[model samples]
Each structure stands twice: as C-alpha cells, then as structure tokens.
Target chain A: MGEFELIERFFKRPARRSPLGVGDDCALLQPAPGMQLAVSTDMLVEGRHFLSTVDPLRLGHKALAVNLSDLAACGASPLAFSLALALPAANEAWLERFSRGLLALADSHGCELVGGDTTQGPLNICITVFGEVPAGGALLRSGARAGDDIYVSGSVGDARLALEVFRGRLSVPAAVFEAARARLEQPTPRLALGMALRGIASAAIDISDGLAGDLGHVLSQSGVGARVDSVSAFGLLASPGIPVDTALDLVLSGGDDYELLFTAPPSASKAVQAAAAASATPITRIGTIHAEPGLQLVDRSGAVLMRRFTSFDHFA
Target chain B: MGEFELIERFFKRPARRSPLGVGDDCALLQPAPGMQLAVSTDMLVEGRHFLSTVDPLRLGHKALAVNLSDLAACGASPLAFSLALALPAANEAWLERFSRGLLALADSHGCELVGGDTTQGPLNICITVFGEVPAGGALLRSGARAGDDIYVSGSVGDARLALEVFRGRLSVPAAVFEAARARLEQPTPRLALGMALRGIASAAIDISDGLAGDLGHVLSQSGVGARVDSVSAFGLLASPGIPVDTALDLVLSGGDDYELLFTAPPSASKAVQAAAAASATPITRIGTIHAEPGLQLVDRSGAVLMRRFTSFDHFA
Candidate 1:
C-alpha cells in the first residue's frame, strides 16, 4: 500500500463527540464555558530533532512532551491535539510503538487526540496542542514587570549533557548516562507548577532553548530586563560527577530543557515560595527582573561575569 | 547559518498582541467570547502531493487552503494557524513567494499566522488551522440520518482532470485546460455555503477525496447508507465543454474537489434552498440517506455503477 492508503487504514478513525471530525475540513471542539484556549505547535525532524536509531516510543513521547511544555509555559491545561506525521513509508511496528508512546502521554495529561494528518516523506512529526485557561488568566511572557523575581523550575543542562553522551563526545558514568538519557527522552512537563503559578507569576516561559535564550523572550516581550546570577545558575553543575565548566555551558546555552522560567511580583514572593514548597517540582530563584532592556550575568562578588548574551538559536 | 537559524531570521517576527508568540513554548489566544474552536491539519510532500516543478506560490496556497477548507466544512470562522515547513535548503525567492501566497490566503480568510516551526529536509509543508464557531453549532459528519437528502456544492473532477493533464496523459480544449488547471492549482474552499449550512444541515463534509469516498465517511460515521442518483450527479459536469459520461467518472472517484457535501433533514429543505439561492452556491441533491449501511451509485436505469472506492490515501 502507498502512504495515503496507510493513513486511511490506520490513522483515520471516528471522533466520539467532535461535531466535525476526521473526514471534514476541520474538527470542531467546544471548550468548557469560561475558559480561553491555549495553543502550541512543535515539529520534530529525523536528524535535526532526533536520531533515526532512537526508539519510536521515546520519539513520540518527546514530541508531545515538548509541545505540552509550551502549554505549561502559559499556565494552560492540556485539552486536545492534532498530529501531522510525514514518513518515508508505512511500518506497522513503528506505528504501533510510536502511537503507544503518544497515547501514553496524552492519557496522563488528559489531552485527547482529536485530529491529525499523515503523509509520505522523510520522517517529520508536527503536533499542535490545544489547551484551556481561565478567561483573561493565562500566564504571559509580556507580563513580567521590573523588580519582579525570576525563578526556574528544576535543574537545567541534563538534556544537553545527554546529547553529549549520545554524540559519544563524553564518557559518562553508566548511572549518570542512564539518568541523563531518561531526562532527554521523557522529560516531564511542569503542568502543575504552571497551573500553580498562573495567578502568582507575572510572566512565564519554558526553557526549551536554554534559560538565557528563553528568558530573553520574556524580557523582550515584557519590555524589561534581567540580572541572572551566574553562580546560582551553575549550582546544578556541582552535582557529583558533572564537570562544572562544561555544565555551566550546558546550563546557559543548552536547548530542550522544558523547564519553566517565570517571574513574580514582590508581593507574590511568599505565595511563589509556598506553591513551590507544596509541589514536587524544584524551584530556584536565579535572578531578578530589571528596568533596563538587556540580560546580565553576575558572579558571587556581584561582579559582571558575562557581558554578552548567549542561548540556543534553532536557525542559527 | 543553519536551518533553525534561518527560520528565526525569516519566519519569526514579533506580534504585538499574542501573549505567547514565537520563541516561546506555546501561544495563548483569547477567542472572542461565546465561540467554540475549529481545528484542522494537513501535510503535503514533494513528489507525493505535488510535482517539484509546481509553483511555490500555488503550493503555499494549496497547503493552507486544504486546512482552511476543513475549518470551512465545520462552518467555523477562521482565526489563526501554525505552520511546520520542511525544506531541502534556503531559497530566498522561493520562500518569499511561498509566504506571499500563504499570507494572501490567510488575510482573505481572516486567519493569522501565529506560530510555526521550520526545518531542513525533503520538501514538506504541514499546516494546522484554528477557527471559531458558535457554541454547539458546528456541523458534523455523524449527524446524517435516514431520509436526509444528500447535497454537494459545486462541480467535481476538475482537479483530477488537471492532474491527468499535468502528467501529459490527457488533452482537452483551451477553456477546459484553463478551468481545470485553475481548479487544480487553486481549489476554492466553500466557506459561504458551510456557514449557511450551520444548524440547517444534519451532516456535512468537504469533498477532498471525491464524492464517493468522502460521502462514504459521512455514511459510515452516521451509521447509514446512501443511493446516489448517478445521472443527477453527472449533470453537475454539464458545464461548458465537458461531456456527461466523463464528468460522471470525475464526480464519482476523482478527488481534490474542495466542495461541501452535506445531508439535510427534509424539514430543513426550504431553508437549505433559500440559503443556496441567496448565496448563489449551486446545491445539487444527489442522493438520500438510507437505513442500510453502504454507499451505492445507481444509473438512470437503476443499475449499479462499477466503481472502486479509492481517493487520495496518505498511507497508500
């Protein structure tokens, strides 16, 4: 069978309640009353985003997780999603494993697979997720105000280190190798943390393109600036076996962390602390928002550690 | 610069209103109050969906049109979309033309380019469109019931004929060539008819994979069957210079006609007729829903037409 036939036989199925589903021009979805929609799209390519040798399940998981992370950045609850998959040919085994991985994450997140398209080409998977937030209550990158405190959930650089091991450039301990690989393959989306921060955090974003780069988006959009403590940012590097200097680089420029970086007004500091304390997620205050329009890194002595800004650039 | 960097340079731009625009994990959109959402996705691959020599502008238009047609089928007003583009290399002129075509259609349909991903590979373009509909008012494929009259807006088979001509296997008059080629290159999405059908038609779908195949979806979904009058269906092909017999074949299984195929209850016939008259969209009653389950095409003499149930199957 050709690619088109494969999609017809396998991917096309009836939607339980969607007014206009698979065969229509578009799928119709009705959101719960009083909720605004949160939307995100992510694309994964064979060589650029993942290796061809990677497990189909992990690839599917990562694909949905990365997009879900975007929803988390906006403090939106996952709802539904559509996938557009392009592949060289129909492989029944690969489809089974890939769909299993995708459905596993979808079930956990309460997101339904509402619509999608499948085609023939080099392996490329694009997922667009739809979510909901209370009307006028979504966490926005444009909401960060000067004098707000900046926080990051969990540690960064693990994904980058995993990439190093995957590239065979780093000889890591077996335990560390497995842990880092897991982090890269199936990073958890900070959905609860995002929901918790909705009212308290003035602005929020996920660190997909490294903390420095993603934070820059918030700074620029909010018309504010930041002063990140380099020493505090690199604290995770001190964890047992990681090289401090290399870890520092990964922490700054590594992409695909999927950790939420947010800002809260001074009055919300207590609430932020309490929310972080209540959750299983780790939150760290790494810096503060500034009135000036630029990113700065400071050392322990408050000396300027870096004057130039750096982060992952997908196109660069 | 790398592929990712190229995307940022050309495709990424600042949006004044989107709370979460490009460079963030996701986008937060506030649809106008009291409206539900319509979502659709489509993927196009080189050598599969279109020839390599096809104009980039037409490619962009067709890609976006396919998704918009989905929204149209749902009777949803267009809102915004995300694009995932895969290319072999950076071609400035081609990109310019492609974007122009995409933007032109988006502007015409009142949809915005909100977020997207760009990567390097064999040429493929996937677009996901979001639209808005009044709550509980979107059209669906499963709503068709026995005794509902089946209708299709506009003539079919021109697109398939154009492809035949493109492959140099068919030759026709200049007028036929021009009309068919236009239909192939820029198939019009029946947005007006769809909007009119909202709450009036029992079930609806856009005819992308020919009337027989797409209508089969509506029949299967609604748990009903249909006996389309082959002679009446063929009458739609009587326009200009096309022969009746040739048109019948095109109408039956020649896909790529982005027309609305719907089934309306007898009680709504007057309303459907009035709306079609007011909107000037030709609405042809080709068949009627049946209690049994299967699709059949009967000639004037009541003989079953010998035809295969095949259209564009992504997997095939």
Candidate 2:
C-alpha cells in the first residue's frame, strides 16, 4: 500500500464530539468567554528523553508534567491537550500504562485529552497542551526590573545529580540516591507556585536547562542582568549533602530541576514571602536584578566569581 | 555528548517574551483575544512519510501540509505551531531549506513559528499547530442530521493514483503522470473551502483517509449513516481516463485527498451551492445522510452494492 493508504489504514479514527475535530483545515476549540488560551508543546524521544528501561507510566507522567509546567509558568489553568506519539510498534500494555499515567495527570490538572495521533517510528512523544488564563494576565520573563529580588522555588540539581548517578559518575547514600532517582523519574510540575506568583513576580521562568541558563533567560527577556550571590544560591544545597563546590556546579549547570525561578520588585516581597510560607514549595532569594544585560555570579564578599554562558543547545 | 546534554546545548534557546519557552517544563503561548484555539498535530517518519531521495524542502512542505490539512478539517484559521524535529545528524543546508519551506507555508498562512525542539535520532518530524475560531462557533462532525446532503470539495484519489505511478504499478502520459505526481508530492490544503463551509454546513470533515472512512467519521459522530451514490463519486475520474472500477476503488479507499466533505440540511443546499460557486474550490454532491447507523453504497440504479470499511486505523 502507498503512504496515503497507510495513513488511512492506521491513522484516521472517528473523533469524539469536538466542535471542530479531525478532518478540517484546523481543529477549532472554543475557550470560555473572557478567558485567554494557554499553549505549550513538548517532545520526548526514546533513548534521549527517557531510557528504554524507563517505565512507560513514568515516561508518560514526565511528558505531561513537562508541558503542564509551561502552563504553570504562565499561571494558566489546564484545559485540554493533543498528543502525537510515535512508537516502533504497538504494545497494548505499554499504551495502557502510558495512557493511565497521562490521564491521571490530566485529571488532576483538570485538562482533557482532546485530540491525538499515533504513528509507527522509533519511539517519540510530543504533546501540545492548552490552558486558559485571564486576558493580559500571563506572567512573562520580560517584566523583571532593576532591584527586583530573584527567587527559585523548591530545589535544583536533583535530576542532574541523579543523572550523574545513573551514568556511574557519582555515588550517594541509598536514601539520597533513591530520592534523586525519583526526582529524575517523576518530576512535580510547580503549577501552584507559578499560579501564586502570577501578579507578584515581575518575571518568571522554569529551571529545566539549569539555574544559570534559565536565569539568563529571565534576565535577557527583562532587558536586565543579574548578580547571583553564590552563598544564597548554595543555600538551596543544604539538604543535598554534596561538597559545596560540587553542589554549586550542580546548581549552576545541572539541568531538569523543573522549578520556577522568578523575580519580584521590593514592593511585592512581603506578599511573596507570605505566599511562599503558605505554599508547600520552598522559596529562596538567590540574587538581585541589575540594569546590565548579562548574568554574573558573585561570591558572598561581592567579588565577581564567574560569568556563565547559555547551557543545553539541543541542536548543537 | 549524550542526548540530554545535546538538548541543553542546542535545543534550549532563550525566549523571554513567551510565558513558557525553551528550557522550561513547557512553553506557553497566549491565544489571540476573542478567538477560540484550534489544534492539530502530525508525525512524519523518514521512511514512512518520505523517501530519503525526496528533496528536504518538499518533505518539509509535505510535513506542514498534513498538519495544516488537519486544521483545515476543523475550519479554524491557523495561528502558530511547535515543531519537534529528530535527525540522525545536523545537516546545515538541509535544515535551511527545510525550514525555509516550513516557514514559507507558515508565513502564507499567517501562522507563527513559535517554538520547537530538535534532537539526534532517525529523521522524524512532529508538528503541533495552534489555530483559532470565533468564540462559540466551530463546525463539528456531530452536527450532521439524517436528512443533510453530503458534499465534497475538489477531486479525490489523485494522490493515491500518483503513488501507484510512483510505485511503477501504473503508466500514464508524462503530463498526466506529473500532474498526479504533483498531487502526491504536494496536496493542496482546502483552507478556503473549509472556512466557507462554516455555519452553512451542519457538519464538516476533511477527506484525508478516503471518502468512505472520513464519511464514516461524520456518520459515527452524528449518530447517523450515509448512502453514497457511486456513480456521482466517479465523476472526477471520467476525465482522468482511468477505468471506472479502478477509479471507484481509488475514490472509495484511496486517501490523502485533503478535500472538505460536509453535510448540510436541504434548506441550506442553495447556500452551499452559492458558496461553492464563489469559492475557488470545486464542490460535488456525492451522497446523503441516512437515519440508519451504518454506511451504504448505491449504484446508479439505487441498488445497494458491496459495503466495505475504508480509512486509516492506527492500531488495526
């Protein structure tokens, strides 16, 4: 059979009651009146994003979590999403487990699985999430101004640390190792923290490619720079129990933290403090925004220690 | 470097303005005001979707076109899309031309190339398109009623025929072969016809997986069936000089037509006719919706012919 015939035989299925479901030039989704739509997409490859040995369920959760985190970055509430999954072959059990994990997350987030496509290939998964925010109210990276305090929620470097362990470069206590591995296997998307920071934080971004790289994004977008105090940044490493230098490296360059790094003006500090107290996520002040347009790391004595460059160029 | 590091090094570029962009759990985009979101996604594998010998530029166009066709199926106006591209290795020239073809289509359609991820793997492209429709207004498959007439825009089976020629199973005049080959290589997206069918048609779907399979979608969604006049369906084949039986097979089962198939109430027939005339697309009445819940094919004498299932089924 030809490609068209193959598509017909394997890809087309009857859609549910979507107002504009598959078969049109585009699928139309009606957002509730007065709501703004939130959109995000993520791609996961077999050996790249997840080990072939990874559980399909966890893989699925990570996929959805990653996208939902983007929605959380904008403080948008989940609405629906479409999935594009490619697999070497159809495995009913794998699909069932994967779908369960995905649906579990979707159910918790109140997002519907509105549409999807499945095809045969080396395993890859791409999900596009749609959410809703109030009009003109999405938190962005461009809003930070000079004198705003920079903050990162929860911890950083656990995933990267876990990767080091996975690659046999680092060894840790059993409990710490398991914890780090779990962190890598199943990340908690900080949607609540993101939503809470919406109005208070001047700018916000999630730490996926590492703190230094992600912070650069916030700074560059805000047209401002930052001087991150290493002492303050290292404070987040207190519980991780690695050497100060090693911990600093992890925090700086280790990726997949999935935590929110944000900036808030002095006027909003008190509100942020209270919000952090009420939220389960830990928040720490790590730096301050500057008028300059580059990121710098400073020692506690205020000496410039390092100037970091961007991390994780996927194509390069 | 490994895959994860590669993603961090290359794929995670900085985007400060987007609520969620690279280096985050997900990227977030704000839908335009007063517009409902439209979404569709498609995955194209190297060997599955295109031959290695095919031009990268054309491959790129075909990839985008398939997803755009999905958007057209829903009658939504295109806006933006995120792409997840996997390649065995980086090819600068291939990337440039492929991106040019993709961006050219995006520009023409007013869709922005908002976000994407690239990685090392076998060639695979997954694109998720975001579009918009007027709030509270979208064409749906479930809206078709039993008495509605079924109509299709443009000719069908040309792509399938072209594929047959490409496979060396058929021979035709050079001009005819090239015309068919063009249809296979670059199927036109019926965007205008879809937009024009909005409101006028009770239900609409694109014919990507052949007439029978796509019609089955409307029938299932609308809780009705259909009776297609085989004679009328073969009208397009008359000028193509192909055998009637072969043409019928192509019409009934061949896919990738990318034509809009819609059902409208009898009262709106005149309006559909007028819209079809005004549209740059050709519209043909090929069938009628039936109160029954299964499809029926009829010959010129109104006698039922052999019924068969037609369309793509991923798992099957």
Candidate 3:
C-alpha cells in the first residue's frame, strides 16, 4: 500500500475532540476557552528506545505512553496526538497490531489521533501529544521550593532491571523478569495523578531517564538542592533478587521509568496524598528539597552516602 | 556530549509566544482566545527525503518548511513548532549549521521552537508545527464546490527536475541545475498567500506530492472534478531546457514542490488577484472545479489531453 492508503487503513479516524483529524493538510484543534495547550514530543528508535525483537503492539503503546508521560508531568489532560512514523516497510500485520494498541490507549484517555506523516525508513515512532491545562495551573520544573517534599508515583527501576536481563548483565526469575519486561514495554502514563496534583504539586516531572537525572532537572530549574533517602527509594524497585547496591543504582539512575517524580510543600503533604488516592495511584515520599546546592543521597539513619551515578546519555 | 547538553547548546531558546519553551517536559501554548490551533507533522528520512550528501543546513530548512506548508495550506499563521530529531551521532558542526538554517526560517515566520526530543538513531527529523487561525476562518479541502476556479501559487516541477538531474537521468545547464536544486532544497512556503486568500479560497492544500496527486485530495474531498489547463500549468516549470512533454510530466506530477493548490469562486477572481498582490506571491489560474467526478487535462486548443501521470508514493 501507498502512504495515503496506509494512513487511511491504519490511523485514520473520525474527528472527535479535534475540528479536523487525519486526511487534512493540518489538524484543527479548538482548545476549550481558558485552557492552555500542553504539547510534548518523543521519538523512539529501534535498539535505542526499544529492542528490534519487541512486539509491534507494545512498541506502539510505549511510544505514545512515553509522550503522554510528559503531558502528565505538566498536569495536562490528554487531548490529541500526531504520530510521525518511519517504517522499514508497510507490513500490514504489524500495522494492524500497532494501531490497535495505539488507538486503544488513546481511546482510554480520549486522546484523538489527529494527523501525522508516514514514510519508508529505519523504524522510528515519533509522537507529538497535545493536552489541556487550565491557565496558571500547570505543574512545572521551576516550581520546587525549599522545604518541599519529593514524591514518586508507581514503582521505579523495573524497566531497568528488565533491560539488564536483556543485555545479559543480570539474571532474575522468569516471573520477575516478565513483570519487569511488561513495565519496560508498556508504561502507564500518570495522567490522572498528574491532573489531580495540578494545584497541589509545586513541581513535577516524568521519570524517563532515572529519578536522579530527571529530578536533577527540577532541582536545577527551581534553584534548589535535594536530599533523597536512598533506603526509601530502594523500596521502589519492584523486581527481586538483586544486590542492594545494584538495586539502588537501578532505582535511582535507571531509565525508562515512566513514573511521576514530583514535589509539594510539606504543608501540602496531606493534599498530595489525597490527590494520589483520588487518582488511584500510589505515592511514596522519598526526598526533600533543600536550599543548598547539590543532590545528596541519605541512608535510613539520615547519613549521607558517598557515591555517584550518571544517567543515560545517548551520545555518551 | 549528553542529549540534554546537546539540546541546550543547539535547540534551546527562551520562550516567546509559547508560555513555556524548550527545557520543559511539555511546552505550554496560550493561543489567542478566539483562534483555533492548526497542527501538522512531517518526518524527513535520509535517502528517502533528501540525498545523503545534501547540505545539513538545507535539509533542516526543508524539514520544517514542509510542515509549515501544511499550516499555510490551512491558512493559519505560524505559531510554534516542536522538532524530534534522531541523529546517528552528535556532530557539533552539522548541528550548528542545521539549526541555523532551521531557526532562520522559523524566525522569518515568527515561529518559535517550543520543545521536542533528541535521540541516537538513524538520521530522521520530525517536525510538528502549530499555527493559529481565527475560529471558522481556516481553509479546508471539503469546501470546494462546482464552478470554483482552481489556482496554484508560484512555480512547480523544478524540484523534480533537480531530482532527475541528481539521479543522472537528465542534464541541464549549470545555472538551471543550481536554481532547480535550490527549489528542491528550500521551496518557499506560501504562508502569506494562504493567509491572504483565507476567506476568498473555498478549498486549499499544499502541493508536496505534485499537483496531480495533491489536487486529487481537494477533488476527492469536495466530491468534484476539475479540468486543468495543461498548457497553462506547463508554464509553471521554472527550469529551462526541458522538453515540453517531460516538463509537463514534472509540473503535473513532481514531488517536493511545496506550493499552494487551492480553489476560489469565479466571483472572487479579483479578490484572489488582490490577495496574491498583497502577499507578493504570483498565482495562476490552473483550472475550474466541476460537478463531474474525475480530473481532466485540456490543451491550449481546449482539446482533451490523453496522458496518464502518476504522483509519488513512498510505499508504492
């Protein structure tokens, strides 16, 4: 099939929230009055973002889910998305499963597939997502203040554990590996939790490149330091059978964890918990923002730990 | 350098029209209260979209220009754009030149670089552009009616001539080849002309996959037919020293010509001319939309031309 037919058969859908959808030169979006549009884009490539042997369906879900995680960090409600895909070829079966997984997630979130471009090339999935956030209500990295309590939603480091196993660097039980692999392949975007924390959280970010690196952005942008309780954070590793040091590294510096890492003023701790409950997502407080200037890791006894862990860098 | 540093060095810029720009998880856009957002995405892959030896600067410009062409076709004023790029490596010199060309065109159009993703993979540049049009003012492909006059802005087919020359299929004079290559590399988007013709044009689309195929969209969407004047369209070949038949084929079915193809009523002919003059972009009357259901080509003598032309299809 040609590009047009491929789009028509796989991605085209009737206009929903959008004024115009696929098949148009441009998709027209009418954001409700008084709402600002939140936009984020992510490009996933084979062997870098995903394995070549990955199931197409999971790849599709992970592609959109990762971008939605960005919107979630901004406390935006998913609205629409455009997918620009470069496939090696138009494989009907692969497109069928991929679109099914993609549209299923989009339907669950009411994020319409508006428009995109498709061409022949090395496999790459680029999704640009649009969401809506009320004016002055978006959670941002620049909002973290000293005395804020840092929290993370869902488990962390499971994806990294799965990656380690795939790379033959580690071994785990099949059940543990399967669970971790699922987390790596299909991450749940914390849209509900993010929107619920809109007015409560001072700063927020999705943990795509490990908590240390991702939270570093918030700390740097907000001009604050952070003291993460390593013991508390280590509890977030969902997979079993790993050394404490190795597990701590995965939990703190592992990538592909789509959980939300956010902060709220200590006074708003109760409100943060309420938002977490309302969204049906668990939250764990693991750190504190400080006026000082660097990230520090602490043990259960509040003693500083001397170690360094670098985050994932594609070019490094 | 790391991905974060690379973005900071090259793509990061202070927020302009957007409430938030690069460095944010999601960029926040506050569109004018009464305006509708027009979004479009286009992905360029090496070898398929451009020659590997093409200048990085021109490649960057073309990547965003093609997407902006979609917004222009919808008669939307440029707002901001997100670029998701996958590079094989972080080459400082290439990124510098590429970003310079990309941002130059963006600045000229008053479009800000909002946010995007960067990763290590086979070279791919995906750009998602956002624009704004007054509510109910955006042009569309479904508005054309019988008896509407079809029009196209600027020249066409020069890009195909350049491609053919590059493929060693046809040869042209040095000056002609240079001009044609420029057309292929940096075709001007008709944003001004499109916005100028907003109310006057009934239906519109950007010509990327040649006139025959792109115009086919307008006809199919509007449920109408057209009688294109072959001789008149033949005049649109900006390159010289090409035979009439070959030039006609290139003009009618050449890809990568980012010109605007639209329809306006005969009653709006004067207004269309005024719009062209206002935008300082030349336009030509190529045909008339009819109630019949197929596109036809007629010669200078008004005799039907018996020629079959196929437009570019990536997967075909």
Q: lDDT per model, in order?
A: 0.80, 0.75, 0.90
Q: For model 3, state the Cα shift of residue B208 in Å.
A: 0.4
Give the per-residue lDDT of model 2 (tens digit) for B7-66: 444334444334445543345555566767778888888766677877777777788888
lDDT of 3 by residue, B244-306 (tens): 788888888898989999999999999999999999998888889999999999987899987
Off by over 4 Å in 2: A1-28, A231-241, A307-310, B1-35, B231-241, B307-309
Superposed model 1: Cα runs more than 4 Å off:
A1-25, A230-242, A307-309, B1-24, B32-34, B231-247
Tell me the native contact fraction for each prediction. 0.81, 0.53, 0.93
lDDT by residue for model 1 over A1-316, one digit each (tens)?
7754555555565665444455555677765778777888888888887888889999889999999998888888888889889878789899878988888998898787788888777888999998888878888888999899999988887787889888887767787777877788888899889988878999999988777888888998899999987434343344576666567777878777899999998899899988787767888888889999998888767888753446754445
- Runs in model 3 deviating more than 4 A are A230-240, B230-240
The best candidate by DockQ is 3
Better candidate number, 1 or 2, judged by DockQ: 1
Q: Relative to the unseen true structure, what is the C-alpha lDDT of residue B180 in candidate 3, on a scale of 0 to 100?
A: 84
Judged by lDDT relative to the true structure, which candidate is superior, 1 or 3? 3
The alpha-carbon lDDT assigned to residue B235 of candidate 1 equals 31
Would candidate 2 be rated incorrect, acceptable, medium or high by CAPRI criteria? acceptable
DockQ order of candidates, top first: 3, 1, 2
